[model samples]
Target: MLAWTALLVAIVVSFRPTVPVIWGDTPPFVESALLTLETGRPTVAGGRDPGYPALLAVTVAFGGDLSTVVRLQQAAWAVLMLALAATAQTATRNAAGLVPIILVALYPGLLLFRHVLTADLLFAVFLNLAAAGLLVANCAGRTARCCAVAAAVLCAAVAACLRSQGMLVPIATVLVGACVARPDTPARVAVIALSVAAALALLAAGSRFGASDSDQSSTVFLPKTLFCNHLNIVLASDAARREIVSAAGDRADATMARLAADFAAEPGRWPVLGFFGDACLFDAALDRDVADDTGNAVGAASAYRSIFLAAVRDRPLAYAGKFVHQMAYGASVAWPPYGLEPAIPVSTDDVPLVSDIITRHGRAAEPIDLQGGPVRIGLLSDLPGISAYLFKALSTAFVIAVLFWAVTAVWRRRPEFSARAGIVVVMWAASIVTAAGAHTLDVWRYLVPAVPMVSLMLSLCAVELAACLRRD
Candidate 1:
């Protein structure tokens, strides 16, 4: 009930018009939603996934404003996220498990994005729920297991539709389920194999059939073209084309067109095309520059594409070097400095405050401008820097601790701890590795879904630490 109250208040606060909210990828979503409402088509500025827009359209259909619907959903998800963290604690019998929820509640980055309309918050919620449900199902017997598997798969499918990263959960779930299922039991093995194959087939079909009108036909035809197809849509957009045109004048479209045509002409150029795509689309500095440029939003898009294309065409080595730099930077930090803002649109006057918070706190900076006065308070400032640093360091230590705990749990033939913790570790490791390998690693939003595993592991570590201290 307390959690529900907190979530309700947060949702109300998020709806306050005077709060100067920051929107990361939300403007495009709004555009898409409105477009879908108007024309019965999914058309966004950035050619984003249709999940959020579809959600908004349904809300609007029911006579709710976008802001009201979005804020309510976000708040509900945030509360649910906390509840999941608490449940994970109960499962592990760790009193300190609640600490992760508290930490997440105070996390400015998560708080900021929680109210936005991007897929990250929703993805995180569904992923965590799926994880928790799986844990519960595993702990219970066959009847509960069936329900749990269904819930897990449903949540994962929802997450996947919101963001491509969400597919990882289902994929990992299937893989782990298959590997761990008893081979001697032909029925179980066949069930697992059939389920996994069906899931994969559905994923592939969705990717192929669920494409929007704005999606580039060329890239969609190619296998292993996920990143490239996304890039092509981004590049083919009016904003991108306009930016190149403005930057290089007449040569802009021609140059970009030529580049696209060249790549299309030579299938061998796919690797080079991917390299350029990563540099232009994934670069943290580029994203930061786009965010910092407080001019017209379209102009910002144009400038970003212009800069990216120039970097790719003229200085390929420098572009690749920047990608490497961003990857290294992503691995070292607790959170990246980009993609912290809400996905909904914010006015020009609020850019500076948003920028300052994002830069200082990485993606965890959430500054709520109250209706009453000019007083600004950092929500997470209660923990001193040293203490926060120690907490984060301890979180990392917890990952290692959980590995040991999980190993011991397995050795003792406790499948509950072993399976749950093992799954968390696999997802965590996969998310980190995939993010690290990507061309742009600076956006912490991309890493949000994986944070739950980190939080869970950290909480486990904290419990273990407290236990050791008590014994000592």
Candidate 2:
């Protein structure tokens, strides 16, 4: 009862006095949602997954405001946190059980994200839910095990559908499940494999036949090609560039040569492309960029992949060096300075305080003013330096916790501990790898999914540390 009360209070405090913040990407999702509602078909375009827009469309259909949508997401997040708390309770035999829930309640990052307009919050919730399910399936009895496995597989599929990065989580979960299942329990292993396979089959079928759009060609290759171009033009070695140029068919080689020359003259564009996250180099002034044109996009993506592979084959040393550097930069402790905007949209301007977002890209200036309500916290905008310092501190603590868990889990040979911790470690590595490969290492938002895992692991490590000291 007390735990529930604390969680309720945290939700109220964190959300009181609605602050509606909107991002540049916010409009595309709104447009997609509104379009889907009008057309009565799921729509995905401009490099976005259809799941999020479909969700927003449902909210719109039900006469729900943005605040309403946010509230629902918050509720779902609360339930997930509660489930994690229950898992912790079971893991520790009801001792130190509330630690995970309390940590989640007070986690500023999660709380702040609870109101955002992106699918990231949903992705994080599902990731944690999947993790909780894994815990239950591994540690519970027969009836509970069957139900937990079903729930875990379902959560994994939903998470994957929400974001491209989430696609591998279900597979990872099944593999981890197999490893952790008792030697005598072949049934559990079979259940895990079947669940994952079924989910993947469903997702694939939906993508192939669910939408009515004739132009429903896959957009998966867009990110791959962009990552390759960013890497080849900016990070790859002279030998690698030559290899790429050699492999780039007649049409692309000339552009590649020009990009190589420009890179030699001005290497600063590398960071600009990395941090700002625009595929400026892929199109360049003289080259074509990937786009919605199905055939052209596919061809361009194929060419880019070929060149990247060629570079990797010819200059493995250089590719390795760049990979390490980019990953480190992406996962760095120093928070890039930016104001954390509230989740409220710009239409509500009557609130006591508000943040104005102006978009002027060679057109009439359009401004969105989001209400920040009566009380405003400027922790992200007003005190960026302090925020960065605090983030760095928290990040350092997370690293320590992960290291402790990794060392202890291995030394103890506990499959349960190893499976749970290993899943998180794998996801964390995947996030870094994706960011590094896509040249988004400088962006902080890419690492948000890893935050909850960090908190969960940290709490478990603390509990273990306390137990050890008591024994001593």
Candidate 3:
């Protein structure tokens, strides 16, 4: 009942009139959906998986505006996520089932994005539902097991259709399920065979469809061209080329150039170094508009690549140094809410009370021109005091502890429960690794799916802790 109430409140709050107008991936998703509805093709300026757009298109076909339908769908999914959380709590025998409900309800990021037409919310919802099903299968083996496994696989496939990263969830689920199932049992074999066949069928279908289309081809979907084509595009760009050339020029003019270059370097390392440098320069350049006199965006991209490559060949160490620097810059946490607030004031004293009001109400705060917009004021930005530090430290510690406990539980026992839990952890970890590798680590929003998993794990840990206490 508490979970239901929390979910209801979340639904109400998510649809509040005063919610801020924040720029999220929702706009792109909406555009994609609209485009698909009109053109019979999935195309957006920024690359995206077609699943959510296609879903939206179906909803529009039934008679509704893109934004309205998508927002309604998002709200519905948010509620579903809450119910799944409750289910996870029951399945894991965790007393803290309400934790997922509360955390999700109160999280500013989740609240802000919950009703937005973006793939993240949809991906999270499907992923969590699949996770809940996997947990159920782990706990009970029979027809329920078969149903749970099938549900998990199907949901995971739906998730993957939205975001390529989601493919990891289904793959991880199948592997974990197989490992936990009794060896040579008919059920186990059936589960394994079904999952493997499903995956292969999806891949083959994707390949066939992809081959038929020329303009709509993505290297990401093709196994053979994936890495090379992606790398080639990055290197061939003018931005990277220019950076390479500029770096090479700097090396040629430097005194004792021969003495400076004493290291044995692989030819391949040069391109990698150039690629990293070009990527950094591209990111920095994007921060501000370049001079109009300098060629168009495409030309500039090509020039940047040339400069980047030249730099790599001339002074390998210096190029390598830039790569390390870029990685560090990319890895470091800049701020909690990326682009949430434009200027990070040393203190929020002078900011109007309207700003405060907007922070609370978010987009719902009336009058688009109001001082307070649905802009998030970070706790780090607002309260620099020890209290803020303590709260953050505790929250971080709790999350970390939950993760550690989950990892230990999975490692210590090869139980069915642990196997299912391990898959969730692995998927979360993979998302993190992918984000980190791509140098796109910005907001906690990216880690939203991990929240339910963490909550579920913590609830399980709490139950175990209570059991131990009772025994003692």
Using lDDT as the measure, the top candidate is: 2
Sort the candidates on lDDT, descending order.
2, 1, 3
Give the per-residue lDDT digits (tens) of candidate 1, residues 205-285: 443235354432212212112223235433545554454555545345455654465335434433423434423333223
Report lDDT (Cα) of residue 57, candidate 1: 65
Ranking by TM-score: 2, 3, 1
- C-alpha displacement of 191 in model 1, angstroms? 9.7
Q: How do the residues 178-270 of candidate 2 rate in per-residue lDDT, one tens digit apiece?
A: 554442566655666677677776566423234333221233345343544455443455654554444453545565655546445434544
Clashing pairs in 2: 19-344, 20-344, 21-342, 21-343, 21-344, 330-441
1-472: candidate 3 lDDT, tens digit per residue: 6655765665555444323232334444544555566666654423456677667667767865434554665565566656666566566555455555554444444444543446676777777776766677777756567666776767666666667655566676666555444336676667657766885565334322322221212212222112121233334344544543343343322311221221122224434233222232223232112212342443434443344354346555543454454333322321122223322222223223323333442323223232543434222223335433433443454455446556667578525445545655565554445433333233355556545555555455555556657889
Question: In order, what lDDT does every prediction score?
Answer: 0.51, 0.56, 0.48
Worst 10 residues of 3 by lDDT: 255-264
- Give the runs in model 2 whose Cα sits over 4 Å from its true position: 1-5, 17-20, 34-42, 63-67, 93-101, 181-194, 205-225, 232-295, 325-390, 413-419, 430-432
- Decoy 3 TM-score against native: 0.61
What root-mean-square deviation over C-alphas does model 1 reach? 11.3
**Candidate 3 lDDT:** 0.48
- Summed over model 1, clashes come to 7
